[model samples]
Target chain A: GAGVSQSPSNKVTEKGKDVELRCDPISGHTALYWYRQSLGQGLEFLIYFQGNSAPDKSGLPSDRFSAERTGGSVSTLTIQRTQQEDSAVYLCASRNYNEQFFGPGTRLTVL
Target chain B: AQSVTQLDSQVPVFEEAPVELRCNYSSSVSVYLFWYVQYPNQGLQLLLKYLSGSTLVESINGFEAEFNKSQTSFHLRKPSVHISDTAEYFCAVSDNEKLTFGTGTRLTIIP
Candidate 1:
């Protein structure tokens, strides 16, 4: 069985630019989540999606951050007008019941 | 609202020595506790979890966590750690399917 996977293992961008990080959850997994890991902030939840219900975006730091999960499988986290503070590793995970499987994560460096 | 607290930011233990990583959580209702570990240059993986039935859970590895509801704590422990045990560990709690993570603790195994 394949585990969760994220694209663009590394991304370097300039400030004010927009970056999109993609995540492919495990098959048949109904729950998906996005998280951010940085030196300042250890691990912060970004968003969560379960089936066709609304996503829990409470952990999103600002309005510039948004995410969409298509067909309840692939998820894309978009950060608009990227800032130096946004430089961090973005991690994605999928849940089947209790345990969550995480992806390698996409490291975004805002220079 | 749920929150996790990992008081220790880093722990350095000698090889074959016992280690304990403390994790405490606060929530309005009953919650599920989990420990996730990230090795060097790797994605986070489930170390252990306590959802129901037993208050203690153990991973295939030598790691184990005891969920103490009275203390609101789920601390990870290992009798004897190996050099490969060096990594970052995160404590998370969930009440309504949305997880709240702690700052994470970096474990360094000293030779």
Candidate 2:
């Protein structure tokens, strides 16, 4: 069985530019989540989506950060006007029951 | 709301020696605890979890964690470690659908 998968294992972009990171959750997993991992900021929850329910965006640090899961499977995390602070590994996870399986992550560097 | 605290930012242990990584969490209600390990250049992998029933949970790789409700802790321990154990260990707690992760503890095995 395939685990959660993320695209663009690494991305480097200029500050103020927009970048989109993609995630494909395992089939049939109804819950998905995004998190950021940085040297100073261990791991921070970003957003979560559960089935047809509204996604939880409370963990998003600012308005510039947003994410959406379409058709209850694939998700994309978009950062507008990226900042140096946004440089980190973007991780995606899919949950089944109480356990969440994580993806390899996409490292985003804003130069 | 829930939060996790990993007191030690780093833990260096000799191969074949016992090791312990402390993790404490705070939450207003019942919560689920988990230990995720991230090897260098790899994604986070579930090590162990404590959901219900037993106070102690064990992973296949000789790692275990005890959920201590009284102390509000779920510390990970292993009787002996190997060189392959060098990695980053994250302790996370979930009160709802979202997880709160600790800063993470980097484990370095010294041969």
Candidate 3:
């Protein structure tokens, strides 16, 4: 892909249900990141993965939030037993520790 | 820890008007500053960055930001803004890794 790509442009799930969002980063990008953006709010960092290094998981809000980037290409963000507060745009970005390219994003709604 | 602060939550200006978006940061070590723009339904894309030297950095779309170390500010400016420039702008700072962002400023360019 010429840019980062994400699946299911929108995900509407009921509260207490689990949701999985996927991201396919740009080819050759070694760093991947996930962020959450609520309505009219700034991005909240979620996680960052670099090569084979231990992912920087310090930004994950809770144990329910987990992410995995398999083979350094595609990444998935999972929110378990989702709460209404989890409703937001889940954005995926990939970079080389310099300029980042981002996906169109997945809009998650917990009703 | 590095933190960023965007003073304005929203700014409304007439088309072709000059605009300035203010950002401040707090960091204990040398850091990198960046500005990102997000259009509706899209993920964030880098606007510019100030990593080292020159204090001033620019984006391809006529946006420029100046890094002021003493004041801990990286204010973005454009001599003229078009309606297309209306979007949410984010300021981010990173010491060695992991960018911390501020509440974004929504720039609405009115025609």
Sorted on DockQ, best first, the list reads: 2, 1, 3
TM-score of each: 0.95, 0.97, 0.94
lDDT score for residue A49 of model 2: 92
DockQ of each: 0.78, 0.90, 0.67
lDDT of each: 0.91, 0.93, 0.88
In angstroms, give how far residue B81 of model 2 lies from its true place.
0.8
User: lDDT tens string, model 1, B1-111?
Assistant: 889999999999999999999999999998889898889988888888898998889989889999998899999999999999999999999874777899999999999
Give me the displacement of residue B101 in model 2, in angstroms: 0.5
Candidate 2 lDDT over residue span A21-59, tens digit each: 999999999999999999888899998899745457888
In candidate 1, stretches whose alpha carbon ends up further than 4 angstroms from where it belongs are none
Q: What is the lDDT of residue A8 in candidate 2?
A: 96
Chain A only: list TM-scores of all candidates. Answer: 0.96, 0.96, 0.93
First chain of model 1: TM-score? 0.96
lDDT score of residue A53 within candidate 3 = 54
Better of 2 and 3 by DockQ: 2
Candidate 2's residue-wise lDDT over B1-111, tens digit each? 888999999999999999999999999999999999999998999999999999989999999999999999999999999999999999999975988999999999999
User: Could you list the chain B TM-scores for each candidate?
Assistant: 0.97, 0.98, 0.98
- Looking at model 3 chain A, which ten-residue stretch has the lowest summed lDDT? A51-60
Evaluated on chain A only, model 3 obtains a TM-score of 0.93
CAPRI grade, predicted model 2: high
